[model samples]
Target: MTDKMLKFVKIGQQTPPKRDVGDRKDDFNEIYDDFIKQKAEEQSSRCSQCGVPFCQVHCPLSNNIPDWLKLTAEGRLKEAYELSQSTNNMPEVCGRICPQDRLCEGNCVIEQSGHGTVTIGSMEKYITDNAWEKGWVKPIEVKFEKDQSVGVIGAGPAGLAAAEQLRKNGYKITVYDRYDRAGGLLIYGIPNFKLEKYVVERRTKLLKDGGIEFVHNFEVGKDATLDQLRKKT
Candidate 1:
């Protein structure tokens, strides 16, 4: 495990290549290219595999950073993806949006020791994105349906995550949002340059395929009161 690791001294740090400025100006899209499999494994090998993984310590989700990094370095990408998604609902989204410079990569022990930090975010993104491409990402499979139903307000990140977890436990979930389309901030608020709409759309589609219902353009105060909604659920 440590063989592939601790190569930060030799490998150096690298991120996925950026799109041309002219092309970026043409339309809104992700600026950075995805890291190729070889590059991802190489970058993952740069991890020090420190005794105390500050990367996971600083991460809000407390992901198993070192383990997944080792798995990635060892070319066990499916296992890497499984570990990455265990704690985080959307590793791909977090990889794109999370402020890694101030979190995981920021506190990297090697970076502090003068070697460049491992590209944790890019690795996370690559693992999940590759999983999606390989059909590894699938809908929630509930064993037994629950009698109680749950209504989640807002089709944003938090709401969607809650619905997914609840659905995994076999609860009937109905997400209510004010916007006509799902992904309130993701669909309407965030620019395509930062996070593409299709990424959010596909995630929404997965949730729908898992049987989580969405009632968009419905206001709690206008469409129905809290009491009425609670009673219906």
Candidate 2:
């Protein structure tokens, strides 16, 4: 009956076990280990469940932070992931790259009151990654059938997100990218220290599996002018 959130006082703060500086420096792999289930639960329980929830307020995507933290603490991972995905187009990616020290965790009420901020980003990542590993993650459902098709001009995060959303709503989506591969900026701009190329590749594969079309090495200006594509599509 006492199962609830706000256990920070009893639990203390913990980050994932980081690899040694020397070892991490020499490798391109992710430096922080994934939080084990017990550690993830403990960290999630540290949320103060603030009514105002500045953590959620500060998050650009306005994720329901307290809600998912409570779910994770209650060992309800599926619910946590669902709530997280409701607001974020890419929860796991944001969990890995978002500067939490300057955003959500920085605004946590308990952190202002002296306790270390709850490991919100790590907990978010854990919820989603565990969801995937457990087979809870599945292809997004088609909401409805639409005749009109949508053409997205890029394969970066924003364009990919738009394409996925359109496809989910039953619109045929075609993504055109100048690069030979999908994930324009995620592959070219971000280094492996922060994000791995395979993560982006897996997401692109998911989109392909869901009936979204991607045209790589196709240039809008060089290959076909805007007027040409508009006339074609």
Question: In terms of TM-score, which candidate is strongest?
Answer: 1
- Model 2: per-residue Cα lDDT over 43-115, one tens digit each: 8888878879999999988999999998888888899999998887678888888999999999999899999
Q: What ranges in model 1 sit over 4 Å off?
A: none
Q: Report lDDT (Cα) of residue 115, candidate 2.
A: 92
RMSD of each: 0.9, 1.4
State the local distance difference test value for candidate 2: 0.87
Runs off by more than 4 Å, candidate 2:
1-3
TM-score for each of the candidates: 0.98, 0.95
Tens-place lDDT per residue, model 1, 32-95, is 9999999999999999998989999999999999999999999999999999999988899899
**Global fold similarity of model 1 (TM-score):** 0.98
RMSD of 1: 0.9
Error of 1 at 68 (Å): 0.9
